[model samples]
Each structure stands twice: as structure tokens, then as C-alpha cells.
Target: MPPKQNPDAPAAPDASDALDAPPTTKTPPEVIEFWQETKQTPEELAFYAPEYLCLTILAVILFFPLGLVAAYFSYKTMQDNKQSSWEAAYVNSGRTGWLNVFAILIGLGIIYYALLFS
Candidate 1:
């Protein structure tokens, strides 16, 4: 007796069938651009984002309170840069850098006192 086969099921294509069939052309996926597609203005080109994130992180590690303050200013500086407020960014960047430096210095001073005075 012959084996039972499903008549509704599609048959596998042979090499001859492939040669007879038209080639399928798949459309490429659309490439989307991030932000804007247009060119930036002169001022936008001159964007100076001086957000010292590494220093802020280091400062945070050195001294919690003061480093938190420095991190705040660094965040403000980044916000200012995004808002295109160069003057405000400049002020905030300076404040952030100084605060980080001061925080590091304070940590070093504490260490010095602990080691030498002990």
C-alpha cells in the first residue's frame, strides 16, 4: 500500500521550479536620522559643552557633600549648553571645576591629618 500524504500541503520546490520562478527583490529597511536632518547654524556649530562628568564622579567619591554640589553645577553646565546659553554654561563650568578641585583638596587634607597627626 502507498503512504498517506496531505494533499492541501504545499510541495517543496525543485531546482527546475526555482529556475522557472521570478527572483524576489526585497526592499531595504528605512534608515532614520537622529535629531535633525538639516545642517546646524553657526552658533549651534560653536556649541562648547564642557561637562566634566568624570571629574564630578571623582569628586563625588572624594567628598560626598561638596562633590554633590559640584555635580549639581556640572549638570547645570550641561543644561546651559543644551539651551545654547554660553555665558551661563561658562559660569557653571568654572564653578563645577573649582568645586571638584576643592572637594578633592578637602579629602586630601583629611587624609593628611589622619596620617601625620595620628
Candidate 2:
């Protein structure tokens, strides 16, 4: 008689097959946004119209005299060799100094009065 095959035997599971592989990491959206923002150009400065140019010129005119007096005081102090604290004086002098102060309060009292009152 031929040997009978067993019908109740259990099948072995495959060990080489993968069923639970790890997923790849994805990049978050926030980090990708800066590259687009950095490509943008800044807006240009405005400089049209004659009035704007004139106001800029007048501002430079007003600033020049203050700078000149400060420079003159610095020059005089260097010649004297007496501590030469003109840099300190220049810092303390605010916008206008003794030049304008004396010119207004004592010397040309009428000039600033004309500017302010008249």
C-alpha cells in the first residue's frame, strides 16, 4: 500500500517577507516658506517732485552752519593745547551752541527776534 499524505499538517510562514517597513520622513511646510520670501526685492526710495528736493536742500543748508561751528571750535582747541575738550563741548552743545546763543541773546538780539517774533 502507498504512504498516505497528512492533510492536517500546518503551513510555515515566510520570514524573508517584510510586512511593516518604516515610513520616510516628510519636511514641514513652514521651513520651505523662507526661500520664497528671500527672493523678493525691496521697494525703491521716493525722490520725485521739486518741492521734495527743495526741502532736502534747505535741511542740508540748516545743518551745514552747525557742523562748521563745531569744526571751528575743534580747530581752535587743538591750537591752544589746554586740555582741548572741544569734542566734549560739541557733544554737550545740543543742536545749536554758544555761537547761536551769543548771536541771539547778546550780539544779534534783533536777528533771532526778527526770526521768531516777526
Candidate 3:
């Protein structure tokens, strides 16, 4: 399907359309001279942002060591709280090490069987 065009626009001009363009008016000589003579304001310089840098560095330094200490303490607490003895922990169906040992043996047996069969 063909697209529609705007009817309000005037008919297209030729290649020399720039020649028919409007003329630009110049500023007054006094205003131009004043602008030329005036010096622009200097931008503010920042020589030291040491506080911001110091804070960022301090946070990075503290976070890692603090997290490590917290993790170490948690692990030590878990290990030291010995209600989790091996026999009691692995006790299920009234068998302590039997099930665990059998499970390990079965896993090893499967690997052995695979090696033998394969």
C-alpha cells in the first residue's frame, strides 16, 4: 500500500535552496567587543577528595577480615557443640555404623563391579 503525504507542506524547492535562505543579523559592535575583551570565569578545582577515598579503602579492609572472623567463629562453635557425635549422628534404624559402612561398601562394590564387568 502507498503511504500518505502531508498536504500542508509547500512544494519542494530546487537545489539552490540555501541561496534563498534567510540572512543572519550580526550582534552590535559594542556587545561583540565586550565579549571579546571579557575573561570567562575559571572552573572550581578539586585538589583533595581524600576523605571519600579513605572511607572506601577502610570499608574494603574491614569487610573481608570481619567476615572471615565471623565464619571461623561459627565453624568453631558448630564443631565444639558436640551433641553431634558420630555414632549418635549416624544412628538410624538402631544401627550406627552398619548402614553407613554398608552404604560405602555398596558404592565401592558398584564401582568394583563396573570395573570388573566393563
Candidate 4:
């Protein structure tokens, strides 16, 4: 016969149940704010900013895979800019995109000069 189980003892948690459980950490206030901001209504998001688009296009033309990644972030910035709280993302993306472009330009210049002098 199988051993009798103790009814008073707590049952072991099932692996599947563990997988379904939500994360223990509470969402930070800043993250909640950012999420709420990004969910702004369409009317609020109507204004279109061309900076991200321009940077995305420039990056795609000058760079390749890395440019594509920058373009994705730029696109995200555009979407996030609908609400004032999410403006930081737009600024960050724009700054990164521009920096990437400048870095590539500088690198090309250095390579050109190195080849010329050599």
C-alpha cells in the first residue's frame, strides 16, 4: 500500500502553477506613468514630428542593420510622443539617431584620411 499523506502539510506547488504566477516585484511608479502616457488618445497624437522620420531615413541611407535598429527606436519615439509624459522617449530616440549618424560620418572621414595619407 502507498504511504498515507499528511493532510495538515501544505501541498507542493505545481511547476505549471509557478509558470503562470505573476512576477513578485511591483511595477515602479515611473514605469506606470510612462505606460499611461504612451496610451494617449489618437486626437492627442495627431501632431506629426518629422525629426524622427528624417533621422530614420538618414540612418538607413548612411548605415545598414544598425540604422534599421535606430529607425525602429525612432518610430517608437514617434508613437510615444502622443502624450507629454512620454516625451522623454522621443528625445532619447532622436538624440541616439543623430549620434549614430554623426558617428558614422566621423568614422568615414577618419578612414578616408587614413587611406589618403597611407
Candidate 5:
């Protein structure tokens, strides 16, 4: 025989009820600021397109010099704008461009040594 349920008492809490509850604490100010800074408008995103394109194609096709030039312009734009959302894009583009340059140089060195020894 089953035990009788209490009619007047509150029901026991379910584990799934915890998951349905909204967060109690508010978002921190720095996190909100970071989100605002990184989120770009369409125009701002378009502004980065050419820099990104140059970084992608020029790095591979032109032996990394033109890519570095593109990176420089991107960084300069970020600096000139001062606290714009595009700053992150420019910083990433510059870093990727420089890394590509180093990779190309290292690859060339490896190929040269292989050819010389062979």
C-alpha cells in the first residue's frame, strides 16, 4: 500500500526546478564593457574586410611582406580610432600576419637545408 500524500503541505522541490530559475547576480561591469567594445556594427565589420583579405591572400601569395603592410595599416587604423571595436580585429590581423612571416621564413630555411644536403 502507498503512503497518503499531504494535501495542505507544499510539494518537495524537484532537481529540474533549479535549472529553470534565472541567474540571481547581475553581470559585472567589466564583462559588459568588454562585450560592448568587441561587438561591431556592420560598417565597422566592413571596414575590416579589406585588411582581412590582404592578410589572408597576400601572406600566402606575396611571401608575407604585403601581408605585414596590411597588418600595419589595420593596427594604425585601430590606434587612430581609439577604443573602437575594430581594435581586436586589427590586433589579431597583425599577429597572424607576423606569424605567417615567421612561418614562411622557417619553411624556406627548412627547404634550403633539405635541398643543400640532398
Candidate 6:
């Protein structure tokens, strides 16, 4: 049975009207990202190139061969620095220091052997 409607009242909304309307479109959620960036100044980038020429030369006086090798490394370190090759300079510097130490040690060893044998 149909319900009775009052003549003075506004027409009721149709259920089909809601369904017939276009649906709201689904959109992907917005993506947000964060990152940290580092900046360096020229002064901050400045690095020292090590050279032990005097030490290597003295080592040469102690043990000629090792000292010469050490001096060569020292020269390479300086050359690398002049060429703006920091890593190579650093390696050469370390080599020179170690060679100098070995040279001095060998010199002392020679003296010790001479004294012990004499």
C-alpha cells in the first residue's frame, strides 16, 4: 500500500536521484620527502700536504738506499700537492715517513753489528 502525502508538503527526495549522481573521483595521496644537504666552503676544503724532506735526507745519510727511497717519496708528495692530487700526496707522505724510520733503524743496526763484531 502507498503512503498518503500531504498536498501542501514538498515532494520527497528520490533515492534513485542520489545513485544517479556522478561519484566523487578517488585521488592518490600526496607524497612528501625530506633530505639533508651539506655544503663546503673553500677554506673548509683546504688541506695540508706533508713533506719530510729534511728527515728523509737525514735518513739518507744513515742508510743511503732507504733514505733515497724516502726522499723520492717526499718529492712525489710535493709533486702531487702541486698537481692538486690530495690523496696521492697523502699516500706519498706516509711512505716517506715510514721509509725514513726504516732507514734510520737500518743505520743503527749496521753500527750495532760493527760494534758487536769488533
Q: Which candidate number maximizes lDDT?
A: 1
lDDT of 6 at 100: 96
lDDT of every predicted structure (CA atoms): 0.78, 0.37, 0.38, 0.62, 0.55, 0.76
Task: Report the candidate with higher TM-score, 2 versus 4.
Answer: 4
Distance from true location, Cα of 85 in model 6, Å: 0.7
- Cα lDDT tens digits, model 2, 12-48, are 5554321222222353555345324332212111111
Tell me model 3's lDDT, rounded to 2 decimals: 0.38
Write the residue-wise lDDT of candidate 6 on 44-105 in tens digits. Answer: 23664778978888899999999999999999987776666789999999999999999999
* 1-118 per-residue lDDT for model 4 (tens digits): 9999999999999966544354345868775565465644444455434445665666666656666777777766665565443566657566656756874675567679889999
Across residues 1-118, which tens digit of lDDT does each residue of candidate 1 receive? Answer: 9988999989877866554344344423231121233223344647766888998998999888999999999999988876678899999999999999999899888889999999
Q: Highest TM-score among the candidates is held by which one?
A: 1
Clashes of each: 0, 0, 0, 0, 0, 0
TM-score of each model, paired residue for residue? 0.63, 0.19, 0.22, 0.40, 0.36, 0.59
Candidate 4, residue 117: lDDT: 100
Q: Candidate 4: minimum summed lDDT over ten consecutive residues — where?
A: 40-49
Task: Identify the runs in model 6 with alpha carbons over 4 angstroms from their true place.
Answer: 1-46
Pairing residues by index, what is the TM-score of model 4? 0.40
List, residue by residue over 22-64, the lDDT tens digit for candidate 3.
3234757765554344321111112111122232233334344
In the range 1-118, model 5's lDDT, one tens digit per residue, is 9999889999888856543343334858775564466554334445662244444454555455644554565556555344454656566556665655664665567679889999
> How far in Å is the alpha carbon of 106 misplaced in model 6?
0.5
- After superposing candidate 2 on the true structure, give the runs of residues whose Cα lies further than 4 Å from its correct spot: 1-62, 82-118
Q: List runs of model 4 lying over 4 Å from the truth.
A: 1-50, 83-88, 110-118
